[model samples]
Target chain A: MRLDKRAGLSPERCFNRPGLMKTDYRSRERRRRAAWIAFLIVPPMAMMLTFVVWPLLVALSSAFYRWEGMAQGEFVGLQNFSDVLFGDHFAALTWRAFRHNLFVFFALFVVQNTAGFLLAWFIYREPFGFRFHRIAIFMPVILSTVLVGFLWKLFLDPNFGLINQLLEMIGLGGLRQPWLGQETTALPALVMANAWHWVGFPALVYLAGMQRIPREILEAAKLDGCSGWQMLTRVVWPLVAPSTTITLTLLFIGAFNWFELPYIMAGLDGSPYGSTDVLGLYFYRTAFGNQSGGLQDFGHGNALAVLMFMFIAVVATLITQYLRRREIAL
Target chain B: MTAKAQSPDPLFPRSSPGSLIAAALLVGNSVLMLYPIVIMVFSAFKTTGEIFDAPFSIPDFTYVANFTRIWGETSLPGYFINSVIITGSSLALILLLGTMGAYALARYDFPGNSAIFMFFLAGLMLPLKLAVIPLFLQMRDFGLLDTRFGLILIYTAMGLPSTIFIMTGFLRTLPTELEEAARIDGASEPRIMLSIMLPLSVPPMVISAIQNAVPTWNDFFFPLVFIQTDARKTLPQGLSVFMGEYTTDWGMLFAGLTIAALPLTIIYIVMSRQFIRGMTAGAVK
Candidate 1:
């Protein structure tokens, strides 16, 4: 890097030096550079490969083999994948779980993002008590999902719960059904719990993005007599699209792979007629024996995991590309 | 009408009637959001009968009975210690390795630099749970299953991508003249990074630390599958099982939840600015 002639270590100086000396200097410099690169790259790269990348590769391969919890297993050659995709009970279970995931996804998309967008809009203005509001909204994000699930379970308790009690107080007791106990309401109930837990995140992100838009453009739009709706639709919305992209991309992955809240709220087996079953819980159940079944099939588990991985990898890439392109165009 | 929402001083000093309505609605909504947690904390101090009697009443602050019971009876203290160990160790490793990688990538152009950047960035939204099936098997093979050290390694590895991404972005924005001067004055690359860059990189370090640490602490899934023993369980996993077993014990459960949440809640309140800044750093950038 030191090209100046006045420098102590110049390429020209090294080249002009005597043969063995020049070779020694060049070799030493090369070695030092190599060491710097190696020191930086080796640890992080190795860890990612060993723990993350390599494990996924192993999962992909394992999906092809029939293995229980054992050191030795039979090679089944895509049988697991076929079974997961088309086999009788497993296939039905997979699709049923898939549909629930879609419902969860749709609910979160509408509830979380819309609420987030609205909250961010007001908070972005730095209105009175905005800081308090922001803190209040984001507080849940840091709590353990276990606690969130448990708290909501208490809140949704049919007999002694807050939601039902509030309904009774408001003379709408008839509208209050068993939120988590029935088939029709269980998935939505789980989704509502999840939305309650995570709604603040997208709001914060959106607020941050909105903060980045130049104040001049906003003022200029006001001067041009642009309505507030126009200001949002034409200006703020376009500018905050990146945050939208980020939120939706996360939603894409999380909704399909949703687990913890449902697991805690419902159970491992997606009790209440499997209404709250998601790929994550279902995959875990398939891999490990649950109350309904006593079979722990590693091959099928790996296959399901691989399917999830593929779906996320593909959809995540597509959404990113699509959103990023829109960002550039805007 | 609010003064700021439409005041038109090039700052959108919103002053519209709609803005007031929106603001009021926002506050109401935020209150609704916070209502449950409020109930939880208040309920902890209430007797089961009192909880049923006046569900949302202010708690009797003098009553330490529920907390005392939880502290004396439960294994929550052990789980707290376990969580601290796991989160702390993982954060330390993630920062160390992440910053090292970022420094190298930022300073020198290597083969596959962009490719490597893409590889790490791709981890941003990857559902790591998908890899759990094999990660478990691998951990089993390595005798890492049900161990704190195992959780630490996996978490450090898992968080590396986002940590590196944030750090690398931060490092790139810093002026290179200082590094150049250090090199000319006979400082080695590691020395330059450690002595100069590391201190300069503190803000991003804090951000990534919070980013990495919070999730690692709150993570229930990894510990759920990895750990088999109640003695070795992290807080979230342990709390889940504990809550299931103590379903009818509302006061103890709330007390336990409060205990589990207290440390993080305190940290956030104390460092609210930094916490907010750290959490929003990624999205804003």
Candidate 2:
């Protein structure tokens, strides 16, 4: 009753005061830590599970069943998957789409990444106009794909298009092809637009990576009889390999799941002979009927989506594994 | 700084005139980067007849007609409102849940911990469009289809991976001693988080919020699929409708595109430094 250290306990506290105090403190600490961890974890975990993880599993399961409008449909088994993989035009469509995607990847790899690297490298040497250059080049990266698409769509309107007008003014009217409407040029045009929108991101990333490289390394390279190209190839390139991995990985995923820009600029069907028809657009069309065409084949679309997912997952995993193995993290 | 600014090379020695060529090349490239936007801006001012008749010509008059016409005559205001609500609310939820989630993973050791972390990280690669059909169906079933809340929830889910990834790294970098000091001062776990760690993590939160918000505000696909009502459609989607309605209205379409793009450009200009830093931090890590 004295309200001292041992005031409230009974015979147990009296008999084992030293041990009980230590044990009680330890237990309380443990309980407090556990409670803290629990409160921090549970709600977000539950939300992620319900929304993200569960939806993925549901999508996977739905790949097998033929359903529409929430009504349970017959089990089609591997039919959907089969159609996506080995069906008559499915093979051609997927292959063609992938080929077009490969074009996008290579184009981005060469133009966007190389330009990004060069700009970052150049800007490092000359910090004048650094702020202006950074803002101007990276401006497109901040834009939404929708906005970029719309901007370019207006820019390349063929009749009132800026590019054609510029060409005409310069007496290069023959070079003014209907960029997005031509079968030969549509895919590349889309790729160019994408590269323009995306180059800023990689440039900024690479610039940061280059900045992190120790100044002494570059100085040492200079002493070692290195020119700008030699210094870049020998010192900077190897050091910035990690950034390359990130850039490539991002570009790969973006190329595969490319949807918004094409859908916006070229329409859902990718007119002028489906030249701009990426796998993403194809899946979107399949899953949800567009302005032109078929009943919404949810099952087939899910199947196609799963197929596309597997393709991307495998390629991405391989690329990541390869790049990870090769990258010498500084 | 001004003295150094006059001479281009601050770090590297200007060993040769090749540096001048490099500067020229850099300037040219920068112009390449800026030209499309420059043309787009100019095109917005050109009259429809001028757009075709003198497509390359500068506008004769600096006019407010295009801007006034789009906003006044179109559904742009409502669409803009929808975009604001969706992006703002979604960004708030994403930052809130993402930071807390990231803090838990970064600081605490728990059951299924790595597995849980991987579950979130895996979302970084799982493109949401792949699940568009099921998601749409899920929304329909839950009576969420076409609702702003539906977009918000989905966007939150979509943004979780990157936000968590970036936030986790940002939080992990904060010294654990701060939390321990708070604890030693008789602060509860929630109190420490609410008062200490959360405030310290605001920079990364702002970065993530801006990164996530721009895309959400300009998202046309989700709104296109989900929103059916004209009043409910977001700005980008509403602009698409405007484009369709005034297919040949070059002045109006360019004006709409300009309007849609202007806010993001403004935000970018204002926060370019943070945007660059935030983007690099998220990507590099």
Candidate 3:
């Protein structure tokens, strides 16, 4: 064996004799490689554990305890969960917020994802000015959601807003109302704003999927006398099933984690009789308290958060698995 | 090459009725998308009364009074500086630590490698906002509350998962010959990482940077919970408070919004391909 002195030890110290040389060198290299791996990976892993994993564990455990303003009082078992899921006042608000979230999810799926898909389809045809249209559609997606929510709030203002003025100019003045101040229109307005902010995302995803289609497949479909509608519904839709799975799962998560838009546009109370209240806003109010005299109840708040996390995780996984199963291999 | 070149026409002919309909729909959608933003920019140049009177009319582009007022009077400039500091610091840490972790995972065949990768991947599915209560309390205990460094740490932690994911994927695609050569030349592992691998990983670095930078720059929730001091507030939370104060001053609000949005908008317009690719990288993959 060639004795290599560059192993950071004298050959005599590293191995007792020549027979042990190869094994010592191999084991030393293995230890060195393991040390390097640990060195590189441990910082980020520790950061994740400290900030993410630890907080998650604390959130899970804190739900089972009585809390007095950031101080854990006693281990109350599942009482907090019961209070959030079934307590008199909490149950009604929880149900209302849950219903609003469902509405947001359905509305976003219908409006945002549909618009995105249609836009993607149109752009995929490479019509006149398609490049500019691609950029324009995605412009809003790049802006902060806070900015979009605030802008829409100003636009939907009753008197001095642009929407009302435009409605009057276009002879649709009768349709103008305080969109965010009313019970019926508030939730829908929030959904529309969110759709405007995010439609381009799914559009681009679908467009990418469309571009991946082989040219011969299109030719084959055309040779089979497929019309445009048939081509889209039959060929393109199934082919982009992976993108659909992604967009739908993300939409489900975003819908349940809905806070910023509603909080910005409609206020934390989700006012006009809580028409816009979502589980996110409800969790915030319960945990942090609001200007509307809601008390900070960390126990129930953590419980609600745990429930929200589980619901989203389970449903998102199921949706992903279901859609992934349906995706065409090609 | 010539035979392949003339193989097939596009799926839709340009003159067809269907193509025309597609064109019209696209144009209409583009208008729907761009008009509000244009109106916002124009209203930023007009007084509130003028904005109310002619909400859709083009304003004189020379009108800079609202901009001047927002720059001079509001705390927006301070918030802008704070956002820069926090985002810049957090991005640096994320890129550094993320690339290191990614390099280890991509290059080595260590035991438990896939398990560690899966551990990081789990962060993507679990939104950290769900654990705000403990995070808030922990920050308090660590004496990190209301400090920019606390926000930086949280953002770095929050950003590392996707950064590592993107970087690992990209780094794996790089040919191993160069790294192997560097290894044979007696370069240390970290030297190979920093000097060899990282230099070759710029595209994914940019992608990861843009992806994390946008969210870090625009995040409102964490600052709302962690930052109570006015001086440390980032743009989103600061603008929210500023909006509350200037509720009736539509021009000023628009100016503030414009200032808050201008950086990303310019970056997006310039590097739109990268922005789109970066933002959608997770989902598209």
- Minimum summed lDDT over a 10-residue window in model 3 chain A is located at A1-10
What 10-residue stretch in candidate 3 chain B is worst by lDDT?
B1-10
Global lDDT for candidate 3? 0.91
Per-residue lDDT of A225 in model 3: 96
Model 2: per-residue Cα lDDT over B82-126, one tens digit each: 888888899888888888789889888778878888888888778
Provide the global lDDT of candidate 1 against the true structure: 0.84
Q: What lDDT tens digits, residue by residue, belong to model 3 across residues A1-330?
A: 112423554555556665667777879878988998999999999999999999999999999999997789999999999988899879999999999999999999999997799889998888777888988889999898889999999999999988888899999999899999999899999999999999999999999888888878988999999988899999999999999999999999999999999999998989888889999999999999998676778989999999999999999999999999989888
Arrange candidates by lDDT, descending.
Answer: 3, 1, 2
Number of the candidate with higher DockQ, 1 or 2: 1
Chain B TM-score for the candidates in order: 0.93, 0.91, 0.95
How far residue B75's Cα lies from its native spot in candidate 2, in Å, is 0.6
lDDT of each: 0.84, 0.79, 0.91
Candidate 3: the clashing residue pairs are: none
By TM-score, how accurate is candidate 1? 0.93
* Candidate that scores best on lDDT: 3
Off by over 4 Å in 1: A1-20, A328-330, B1-15
Clashing pairs in 2: none
RMSD of 3: 2.9
lDDT of 1 at B47: 83
In the range A176-265, model 1's lDDT, one tens digit per residue, is: 878999988888888888888899888888988887787778888888998776888888988888998899988888888788888999
The residue-by-residue lDDT of candidate 3 on B1-285, one tens digit each, is 234323467568867888899999999999999899888899899998999888988999899999999888889999999999999999999999998899889999988999999999988887999999999999999999999999999999999999999999998998989889977766667677888888888999999999999989989899988999999999999999999999999999888888989999999999998999999999886
